[model samples]
Target: MALVGPEEPHYCNHHVVASTGRTRKMTLVRALRPFRVVRRTLAVFTLGAMVIVSFALLPSNVADAATVPVSTQAVVQTAPDLAKICARLKITVARTSLCSHGPDPVDAFGGGARLKQTSAVQEQGVAAAPASELTALCNADGVSGKRIEVIYGVPQDRTNRFSAMVAPLRDMMRQVNNNLEAADAATSQNYRFLCTNGVDVTVRNVTLLPVGSDASFTFDDYVASLQNQIAFGLGPVDFIANERLYIAYIDQVQDSYPFGGQGELSIDDQPSAAANANNDSRPRYSMSAYLDMPVMAHEIGHNIGAVQDSAPHSSKGGHCYDEADLMCYDDGGLYFALGGTLTFTCPGADTAIDCHDEDYYYPGTPPASNYLATHWNTANSGFLTPVVSAATPPTVTGKSPVSQATRVAQTANATATFSEAVQGVSTTTMRIKNPGGTVLSSAVSYNTTTRVATINPSASLAADTKYSVSLTGGVTGIRDLSGSPLVSTGWSFTTGPAPTITTRTPGSGATGASRTASVSVTFSEGMAGVAASTFKLKNTATGAAITALVSRNGTTNQWILNPSATLAATTNFTVTITGGSTAVRDLAGNPVSTSIWRFTTGS
Candidate 1:
């Protein structure tokens, strides 16, 4: 698995006392070890006592996530300690912990993106939030966003003072929220709920906690608690069962000792700093806190949406000024300079501006995209700002051609609002079988006002023919709210066929003896369920028929074919799937594909 680290030239708005200007020469080490109990959640790295890591990897088709609603009974069963904590905060965990464990609930309002780790133990259960849900929430809010919930595990000696940390925590939450909202709105997908209308997302809060009276709590304990109470009420095992979720943990490993209570350290510690002349071993508590926040943010950023490769500042993954990357381990003014500059909109403004001079950092000055606006706020102002940016922005854009004949229909749409205006729609078009592979009609229509184009035959389009459409030229210009002469790239779309047989895995005239070889097929449309006994297979020679079986996989229209008995050697077999007669129907409400095929069986 490719490891993700921050880009270089670390930037933040936090303060620190010194710059060691040291680099730890690291030897290539094995990547995180896979977790056993939670097969998917691996131990990524050890930072102090905290284990900083993310889920191993998610399945390819990771888009489908579970959506079970919260159950009141489940919430009622939560441990009293958690309930008391919730009560003290005046918040209601409408859903049980199990529900809270998944990305959907934890990040419902973009809360997960703004969190940070306050204590090592808290990092134990740090799991990756679902990227789709996070992205969905970010899009809903019309901004790019992030969350980092810190669990502070203090000894009994420091327990009572938990209230003292509240103000700073609240501030951090606010800053993180603000940045998230801003990023969401300022970027694409402008609002939180494109599913809903445009609206600012209400900022979510960050929760800090003191451990319950458990004798000894291991990382798995937190995982279990979160799982039983939050994930699926089935605990961490569900992580693999439901691969959509990933986990991560970050902690401080070294002491403020021999180094003279100093917080500054290199990403790699080649050697403990040479004894300082003054031997001024004064502890810097806050600096330690500040440094860890950005590191945590950069790591979690790796697991977001689709995991992508990191482009470090020095290219070798060391500190550099251009990227404003927190992963490079650069400790300088840049970490806490974002808030100092009051100019919120100065062009070319960066998280690194004045924090760390370009000369002090290296390689081409990296871009500022990697900067965490909220973390920058935390370092500068001792708090977080809500509003990562707007979540959802809207526009009308759609598929071109409206039809295709040469290949499977492929069309795309462009959101006019996202663009400055709409150009002429494409006239060249052709229609084909809904599943494509067959050409039928080409006539298409474009709505310049709505920015949507329809492709159909000059007459009524076929009910089941999927049409591919595009927009090339010919329509009058439609300007956007920005008045920037609407310009956009091309788009595509597919027409629909009511229901038709698309393709079958084992075509007619096949001969295979493997009993495990099952027959399967794709349809032009979705199908509904019917009485299980409706489908069947038959032997052509004896005229004896058997009622084969069909079952749905996940919610897809695809079905499985179960043969009742082994095929006779050297025998002719025929399979038939009845659709309209059964309960099956395409998504368009068209009849199911009454498909049939015949093949010879070998011994």
Candidate 2:
């Protein structure tokens, strides 16, 4: 039996024994005094002038046959508290008490402390290992299955420093591939890893900028710089669905604290320029120049959507409790032994303590069950599939008020129909700007069924004013389901002059009007349609309602209201236009406001 530290290599010592008929290899340790030993026969012989003693004995059944020379000391080699281990490494954990009783801690040595405090590495801008010569680090000969491209970038000024990291980065990636392959084999999946080679791999020299007052730059800022490079044809072609882009820089990343890398499960295909040139359906991840195999594998695990702290895996809260799990915080091994094996042995299965039990462990306030059984099952076999093609870019096919059109309604909602169904087409992407380029306060929404994006201003537009609607494009622009972005452009239109009642047949305050006379109102602009329900005729004295039929003349923009019955004699009749419906809109769909007029009917 052998005992090793959490992160140390395994070691075993063996001794060969010659028996009467067969040769058996046996392991002997000095610490085996507790168990009773029954000896039946003994023999002594001399080989090369050295005396050798042998004995055949009946061993006690107290120990397992597989673990030879087992003793009390070997079985009692307990692991230390995780909190103590973290404290010794100068790393901080959210819950110290929980960690105290959690999993055993992995020993820290040879820059292991830096790996434990990922955020510290970013803050201090510390390098993990010395740089080496630049060379072809990854082996491509054995990769015959599915491949994912990796693009590494560095600041132009720090090329030499980043070049030295190629060897270690290659080693880390190889380990990650090996671990993933082992996991797939255990889970009965067929996912394999391929290193981007030849023209597929990219090495970019980018400009570094400080984030706010901080001395370091952010991953998002770096991504933006990469985008700018792509836009200018200096960066790699648009990432395809199967590729991932990793930017390596000397400065610390803003959000990556206590970790060496950060990544997303997947990313939308944004426009890019590279050898492949096609839009990629996969997401990209980033790493600091200072990284190790375990940390690198951990980030790739995120890309694999493992142990997510949401939905089906909410109970795991970002990681499994098993210390041997590659997804755990104390991860140190190169293989998956927890959820990947599908044979779950709850940590501390025999103990009644809540902290020892996997089910009652509350890494979160509301205790959650270990969701490993839910996500790591055989049913979710396709979790490792890569997204394939980029989505088609959305195009504007039509607008409510056609470009450069006159007589646009002030109350009309600004609408633009796209060539395909799109999402996230809200106020953030679509904007209505006045001639002065000031964005108007408006609510923007997209209708999937109609493929239309509508922007309704908080208030009606200024009459006779010019406004332009702009939609953004590129990575941050509005995108379709496949993440293809829309091309950005602006269209302008002038609002029509304020609509007014130019003439009324039954003039306001008219006296001695015929009881059977119909009323007519003419507007300056063409009306969309008038609803009969919008016209209300009532006798003021009796407060009696009168129903009427309303009709509109398309060319004249006039609304005619004829009472269903004769108006009351010697009575003051009021005709009112009740608005607030699609029925009473202008040609541009602007609803009219309430209008009232009165006339006296003859007796």
Candidate 3:
């Protein structure tokens, strides 16, 4: 595949503690062996802080993702752990441990994205008010668009404390969202985090994480228990499956040393039924509680798809290769494969995404050849904001063949070129019909790159016929990307004249022609097909047709009549091009009229 991108990564919003001014050197060694199971929920990369970069490549066709909805099921079907699952599918998997950081820490509390809550503060059923400074961090009232739904979960023995921390979580996410906006200023787009839309949305007392009496629980255990109890976010329904990124705030940590959080990497949401399975679709609910806002950001990054293996700096383990960005790490994510080293290139703020813009997030339109343009981009995730505006955008015409034009080609298809990208291209929307209003059997197709929609007729148009093209629909019809319709009476044109003999080899009534000579003829227009019965060579004296093989040259538009036996020497022979709609015809179905010519052959 030809990858189109800048040789070096785009350094747009470089937020780093130190600009070492280092150039990231890379040696790309394709898989030494076959690629095996690489987890979407990869190892947490932490410099005493939690982090996870989700990685998955999305489908290419969908205009916008319709996320899977959460279903009201009592129990969720759980799959085997990553290794076992891969084994069943006959894939070899080897575990690689990767976690480190870029620049030295400046703050004692330090910085990390996605993590565990250090303290379990208690409160009543109501939520705790945020610190005055954190109030503006979130907007929960009118802008109540889609967000990450937070749940309060604890071991059966422990009390749930997330109910008290709703505002704080929202505020933390608000801070992350705001930081994303700042990073994306170059793209001219605002960013928002997945948060509780309106009120403090929390599902309390779902399932229990392993604690107290429970023995050695794996990371998967925590997610499974909670998933079994919470009755939503299964999928299929658009909003339910996709609208919310369901995450739970568990009050306790597990025996597992790396207990920040993890999520399934849907990569890019491939909308097909099989591709959109279990957690494979929606980053379907795995990551858990962490007071650090960036931790949530990093963990959620996995759920929505980021850091594809094909990315320039990708670690191949679902994390980025460089340092200082939220997903990048000091201990190369692809340690065993890439020699386990990363240069401290683009040092970034606590909320950094890719060290450079080439890995995951791109605010503006990406180059058609850029990695972000093809892979799943976190910025396109449905959980972000401001919600896409519902307003309809108009579709304007760029150009088309003028109406009432004459001598149009019989086999030419009709097209409408638009100045802007359009959406509707179904047969019902873009149309081709006879002047009498009879719709023709045709298919409609649109090319986004060229901004053109075409009407391809099933068969060629008839010769000397008038056909009309029209686009219909109000705001909802043959519309632009923004839902504005292409409402036009369209245009029409008339096909050119009928087919006639343009060339005849061996002149009419010519005498002394060689008996072995083959007869040839050409037509004025390109023919749809040549009929065997239409070409003939016969001895005029005997009144019998000559056995001959007829062959046509489409490129030269010539038909050759070769007799099986040599023509009778010194005999008068006749040649004919039989015609009518059923015989030799042009693409427009216009026939070549029956034509005859006679010649006497020489011995």
Candidate 4:
């Protein structure tokens, strides 16, 4: 199926939606990122703010946080900021007297309007009493003042102190923003900012307050009391204007303490009411910037064009460690990217590089940057322009004359120099297609900052054959860190004859039913032909290999035999050839990479 665009969810593909094992709409909703709720809610936060807030302060050691199998306990422990968390969430709020709506929040799509409310004070599915009320409920339950102090941070004895405490955090946010912007420029990939017609950002000022400390809910209450005020109190008009993003702030109803030795981003979720109630009087608390910030961006990133990783339920979506997926459930508070963080390479040692991981930032130990940059300054640096001309495919005018081949037991090394560091075509996307149109294997891999995909086929190449390596669709998905797709068309090349195979040294042998053995096959030609390590010897039973090995006689085509261990006696064996059949020709310009034959070992 064609790739789904950002605004157009993957669910649009009937194949994807139906195959996910759910009703269509629900699958579509599932296809959206976790932040989809936030994106659909806020719709107008700043892109820069989103990136910084999401990635900065991620602690490095969150993997060690307390674990609770139960969802309630998990939520509480994972979100330690719950006590300090006030629902400043911008929701549609209205008083009962002037409004027909009830106090409960609405799930409009779920036919929430049909749900009945018994009283004016009653909460609709979507609406709720003011946050102040929530705070009162939290405090009356015996939550402590110290926890409250942690949530609001001493309420600033004076404006100066308030600014003093918030300034450093603000500076940290700014640094994160700058880093993202630079990386975006370097990679030419869009970051938090989305550019469909115009740029759309997601974020806003967040505030936190201790619950039940005051008789009134402070400014948040006033905002919540507005005629059409929504829950969490963000105005509805703001959302209407930036329909693609979300802007939200933080507020808590009760007192909570920030966890020590953890970055604000590194903090875990607050414990639930039941868990907190069972604790001591000094009630501990935690406000997670890690979960919060990424959640913010995750919501916003959903607004941008990227497919939701709705693979959790499908076997086809096997890799749970898809850090590149914004919709990946595992990405919750851990991830470095704002809009475009999916990477081909693994994340570095720095945990805070993403949102949910350890967010604690200290000097000298900086978070790892995504290899691909997300933005490009068109006016300053012209990296946005195409690097290669579209006139024709690049021709291989010269090649590295040095060539070496080895048996499965030995390592073969070869390096070819390109005319230039060609753009568009990445090493990872390069595939070696056989004459039968079957792809032997991909010849690309993501290495360091560059795409350096290589392949040592599972089977050996035949002797003296001419093979062709055609490059088709080799540069489509490859983008620089700045998110620019490869500009040039794909290219390929044909190589010289394959090395000659002499004879197997231990020709036609069997073992005493040993499980593992490295079987080696030698070649008669020089060890300068195609890669020979790709050969394999398989057992007839389950088509499994007995750890057979292959090696060349350093100078001649004489190959050696060695298996990881001895093989089973009287076992049926078949040789499977693979690497590049077309790329590896036999002595008479014939491809033999696919030639397979069977033999029996002595019992």
- TM-scores for the candidates: 0.24, 0.29, 0.40, 0.23
At residue 477, give the lDDT of candidate 1. 31
Question: Model 4, range 1-603, lDDT digits (tens) per residue?
Answer: 223234322122111000001111211122431223333323233222233223221111123222212321111123233222211112222211100000101111011111111111111121211221112112222221211111112211112223322322222222222222222111211122212222111122333222222221222222222222233222333111211122222222212211101111111212222222112132111122221222222222222211112211110111112332222222212122212222222232111122221111111222445111211111111111122231232322222221112121212212232322344443334443332234454344333333333444445433232122322222244334443333211122224444444454234444343334444555434332233344667777789865644665476544444666666677777665443321333333233344455666666
lDDT of 1 by residue, 242-323 (tens): 2121222211212211110111111211111122101112110111122123332332222221001111112111122232
Better of 1 and 3 by lDDT: 3
Relative to the true structure, candidate 1 reaches a TM of: 0.24
Q: Order of all candidates by TM-score, from best down to worst?
A: 3, 2, 1, 4
lDDT for residue 82 in candidate 2, whole number 0-100:
29
Tens digits of lDDT, candidate 3, 434-506:
6334678998898889888888999998776667665653454666766654433344566777678888877
Query: How far out, in Å, is residue 252 in model 3?
Result: 1.8
Alpha-carbon local distance difference test for all models: 0.28, 0.41, 0.48, 0.26
Error of 2 at 305 (Å): 1.1
Those runs of model 1 whose alpha carbons end farther than 4 Å from true positions after fitting are 1-26, 29-394, 397-478, 481-603
- Clash numbers, per candidate: 138, 18, 24, 136
Question: Which candidate number has the best lDDT?
Answer: 3
TM-score of 3: 0.40
Sorted by lDDT (best first), the order is 3, 2, 1, 4
For model 2, residues 121-236, the per-residue Cα lDDT tens digits are 22232222111100111223323333333344544323344554443344334323333322311111112334344311233334432233223333333443343444333344
